[model samples]
Target: MDQNSEVRLEDAGDGAYEIVGTRSGDRLGRVALTGERVTVEVVPAARRRGVATAALREVSRLTLRDRERLELLIPWDNPIALRVALAAGYTREGIRRGTPELLVYSRLASDSGEPAPRLLPDLPGGELSDGVITLRPLGEGDVDFYTELHSVPDVVATSVPAEPKPADEIRRRCSRAATQWLTGSRADLVIVDTATGLPAGEIDLYYQEPPLAQAMIGYSTLPAYRKRGLTTRAAQLLALWVFAETDIVRLVAGALPTNIGSQRVLEKAGFTREAYQRQRLPGPDGGRLDDVQYVLLAGDLLAQASGAGTSHA
Candidate 1:
C-alpha cells in the first residue's frame, strides 16, 4: 500500500488542517496553526507509528518555511507524544503548569534549515533495582499510595506544608511526576519492596538544566516502611542511575537539621555532607530552619565501585 497516498491533508479552515488516512478512511487527527505555535494530534489508533511524525514533517515543510519559530506544547505525562515531537526534531525549551501540564518544545528556522539538536534525553524506561529494593517510574496507579504517603504526619511536616492537601492536588502532582520523566526535568521513582512488590516509598531527582549534568534528590518513605533500610537502598539505586544513565556530575540533597532521619538516609546512601546553611528553609512553625546539604558525585560512586573490586555494571 502506498502510505503517502493513503495519508491526506484537508484544509479545515481557520488555519487548521485535518489529517486523514485514506486507506483506513480514519480521520487520524488534526493540526492547528496559531501564531508561532503548531499543535498536532493523532487518533489513538494511529499513534506510535510514523503518522504524527509524517504529519509534523509535512507541516514543517509547508508552514514553517518562512517561519522563524514553531512550537509544540506536549503534556508532561504524555511520553508518547513527546517522543513523536522529539523524533520530528523539537527541543524542549521549558516547563509550564496547567491542567494536564505541559513542556514547551520548539524548533528554529535556521540558516541551514536543519533540525535542532536534541536537548532532551529519552525517558528512562524499565526499572532500577538494588538487591533489596527496586525503583520504577510512578504511574496513576500509585495515586492512592502516594496520597497515603503524604498524609503521614511526619511526611507532611518535613516535606510538604503541614496543612492537609485536597485530593485534586495530590492527583495533579502524580500526573506531573509521570510527565517530569519525559521533560527531562525530574524523575520520580516509586520504591517497591522486592519481596512483596508493593510500594514502600518514593525518590525524586530534579535536573537543573537540559545538560542534566547535576541534580537535586529527595525522597520519602511510608510510615510502615521506615527504618527497614528501604529508603537508603532506594537512594543508592537512584544515585547509581544518575551516574550510569545520564551525564550527571553530582546529585545533591538538602534536609532540615532537625530531620535527622533524612540526614541519615543521605549519609547511608554515600552522599557526603556538603554544607549547612542557617535559616535556609521555612519551617512549618513559621520559623526559619537550618538546612544541611549532601552530595554524591560520579567519581565517588566510581571510587566505591573500585574499592568493592566490582565493575559499576
Candidate 2:
C-alpha cells in the first residue's frame, strides 16, 4: 500500500495487527503490540515502510493519555525497535544493565507541542555520500572487508585498533554498529568508491562524553585507493555532516608523528594542526606513542565552504 493510505488499529481482541490495506483491507504482514513495556514487531514483508513507526506513535498517544508516562525498554541490540521508538517521540533516558543490556526510552504526556529530541540521531537513509564516494554504517557483512583492511601493513602501522583485529572481534564490532550509533558511542562507516561501487576504505567519528560537543576523526584507505585523495574527501564529507547535523563545536584528529601522509589528509580536509602530544596514543607494543593533533571548528568549516577563509588549513 502507498504511504498515504489511512490505516487504523482494529480490535482483534488485543493490540495485535495484520498489516492490512486501508481501502479494501487486503493484508501485507502482521504487527503486534503486546502488554506493559510496549514492545512492537512487524513481519519482514511489511517492515521499514512506516508501519512500525505508525504503530508506536498510536500506541504511545493512547497509552500516555491513560497514564502519566509511557516507557520502552528495548534490547540494546534491537536497532529497528530503537528507531521506531525515537521516531514516535520517545526520549532515550539511559540503559538498564543486566545479562542483556536494555536501552530505556520514555515519553511523557507533558512532553507536548514540540517533537522529542534525540541525543544521538539516526543516520538519514542509512548512509551519507558525496558524488565520488559513499559512507554506510558497518555491518556484519563487513567482517571480511575489515579483516583485509587491517591486514594491510601500512594501514596497520598508521591507524588505531593499531594492529589487526581478530575476525571474531571485527564481526562483533560490525554487528554492534547500530547499537553504538543509538547509544552515541561511535559511528564506524565503510567507505565506498562511487564509480566501481566497491568498498574503498573506512572512516569513523568518535563522540565524546556527555554534552557531545567534541568528536574525533579516524580513517584509512585501502592500498588500491591510496594516492587518489579518497580519504581526504571522505573526511571532509564526515566533517560537513557532523557540523550540519550536530551541536559539536570541535572535531579533532591525530596522526603518528612520522605519518606525514595522514597529517596531510586531515589538513586538506580543513583541519588545522593544534599541537603534538607526547605519548598520547597507545602503542602496538606495551609502550605509548606520540601524536600530532589537529583541530577543526564548526566556523572553520563554514569559512572554507563560503570561500572566505584562506586555502591553508
Candidate 3:
C-alpha cells in the first residue's frame, strides 16, 4: 500500500481537516486540519516514533500550501504533546482561558518568523551550595517533591492550615504555578540538599501590583531541612535576583505571630517588621490568628548589599 494513499486527508469544514492512518487493519492515528491549523492525535501504543510528525508534515504541506499561519492546541499538562508541537515548529502563544487544561501554539508560515516566548529565565549566578544546600528554579517536574515535602507530619503541623491535600490537588496547584511563571507573573526557586539533590524547600515572589512594581515573597522549608538556615539563604538570593532583574520596588511578607522561623528568615533578608494585624489570619486548626507584616524596600536591599544599613526587624 502506498504510504500517502494509506492516509486519507478529508476537508472538515470550519478549519477542520481529518487524516486517517491505518496499519494492519488497526487505526494508527487521526489528524484534524482546519484552516492552516492541524491537530494530530495518535494511538498511545504507537507514540514516541515519527508517526505523528509524518502525518503533520503532510498536513502542513497541504494547508500552508496557501496560508501563512498555523496553530495547534494541546492540554497544558501534557508535556509529551507540548514537545511534539514545539518540535513541529509551533511556538506557544499564551494559554486560552475557560479551557481549563489547554495551551495554544502557533507559528508563522514564513521562515523569518519570531521565536516562541521564553518559558523560563537563565539560572542566576550565586553561591548555590555553601557545602550543604543548593538553589535553583522551581520547575513543573518538581510537583512530586513539593507535594511530598509539604505532606510530612511536621511540615503540616507548622504550615498549611488544612489537612494534607490529595495528590490531584497538589498537581493542580503545581499546574497553576507553572502557568503563572510562564505568564511572567511569579518567580519561584527551590532549595536543594547537596547530598540528595531533592527539593528541600521553596521561595517564591509574586507581583502584588504590576503598575506599582510591588511584590510579595513567600518561603517554606520541609521539616527535615529545617534548622540549617536554608530558608534564610534561599530568600536572600531570590530577593537579590528580583531587585537586580525586575523593576520591583517593595517586597511584602506576612507571618503568623507565632511563626518565629519564618519571621527570622524575613529579618535575615533585610525586611523590617511593619505591623501586627489582630486576628488577621486563619489558624492551622481553623480559628483566627494574629499576623505580623514585614516590608522590604528596594533601597533597603541595596543599602544592606552595599554594607551601609541595618535592618530594623
Candidate 4:
C-alpha cells in the first residue's frame, strides 16, 4: 500500500479491529482493547510505517470518548512497540511484575497534559562485613581508588573489555555508578580488606527494575589480594546484604571456565554452577571464550545461614 492511502478501521467483533490499507485493500494490522488496555500488532511489512501508531491514536480517541484512561502493557525488550506507544502519547506508569520486565503505560482521560512520574526509587544504603572483609557503597572520594583498582592487570583482564584506562574514564564509570544507583539500575560496592581497611576489589549487582527479582553479580580482585579469599568473603557479605535489603530472590555470576580463581570465589560464597555456555563471551583480544554461569537462590542463603547457626537469614 502507498503511504498516502486512506487507512480504515473495521469492526472485527468484541473490541477487536482490522486496519486496512485503502489504496491496496490490504489488512495492515490488528488492535484490541480489553478493560481499558490496548494492544496493537502490525504485519512485519507494515511495522514502523505508522500502522501501530495510527491504530493506537484511534484507541486513545475511543477511550477519551468513553471518559476512560488509555493503558498499554509492553515488554521491556520490545523497544519498537514502546516507541509506538510513546509516539501515541502514552506515558510509562510503572511495571507489572511478570517475566523480566513488563512496562505499564497510561494516560488519564481528564489530564494528558503532563508527564507521569518516571524515576525509580533510590536504593537503600548500608555496610556489610564479615570481620575479615567489608562491602560498602562507592563514594566521590573513591574515584582514585576505583581507578587504581581497574588499573590492576588481573582486574582488567576479568572485568573490562579493553585495556586499563586512566583516571578520567574510571571517574566517568564511578560517576555512572552513582546515577545507576539513583535510578535503581544497579548496586556497586567496593570490597575492602578490613584488616588494613584498603580496597581489595569491587563487586556489582545489576538489574534493579521491578518484575526482575533476580540480579547478576560481578567481581574483580587486585593482584595483591589474590589467593587471600578476601573477594570470596566480600561476595558472601554482599549476598547477605542483597538478600536482607532488597527483594532480589536470585543472584547470578558468570566466570570464564579457565578462571578457576573466580569459580572458587563463587563457590566459597555459596553459589552453585548452573550452566556452561560455549563461546558465550567475547574475549579481550577479539576471540570468544566459554562462560560458566553460577547462581545462588534466596533459599540457599537461608539454608546456609541455618546450617552455620548464624542470624544473617
List lDDT for all candidates, in order.
Answer: 0.77, 0.78, 0.69, 0.74
Top-TM-score candidate index = 1
Alpha-carbon runs more than 4 Å astray in model 1: 1-27, 75-77, 93-103, 111-125, 160-164, 209-212, 308-313
Candidate 2, residue 237: CA error in Å?
Answer: 1.7
Cα RMSD for candidates in order = 3.9, 4.1, 7.5, 14.7
Model 3, 1-313: lDDT tens digits are 2364545545666655454554445566777756655678888876887566656656666666578878887775665666566555667677677847577877665743323443333445632455566776666688888888777775665554536777887677676554455545676677887778777888777775877878888777777778777777776766776677767788889887778878887888788999999977666657877879999987888878799643322
- Cα lDDT tens digits, model 1, 1-313, are 2355557777899878888887776899998899988988888888777787777766766776787888888875677777777667777788778775678888776523344333234436688776678888888788899899888888887774456668987787787775667666788889999999999988988887546577888888888788888888877777777777777787899988788888988877778999999977777778777789999998887676667543120
True-vs-predicted CA distance for residue 280, candidate 4, Å: 1.4
Residue-by-residue lDDT tens digits, candidate 2, 54-96: 7667666766677777778887567877777877788878888
Clashes in model 3: which pairs? Answer: 15-34, 15-35, 16-33, 16-34, 17-33
What TM-score, over all chains together, does every model reach?
A: 0.83, 0.80, 0.62, 0.59
Which 10 residues in a row give candidate 1 its minimum summed lDDT?
A: 111-120
Quick one: ranking by TM-score, best first? 1, 2, 3, 4
Error of 2 at 67 (Å): 3.5
Candidate 4 on 202-234: residue-level lDDT in tens? 888787445768888898877888788788777
Assess candidate 2 and give its lDDT: 0.78
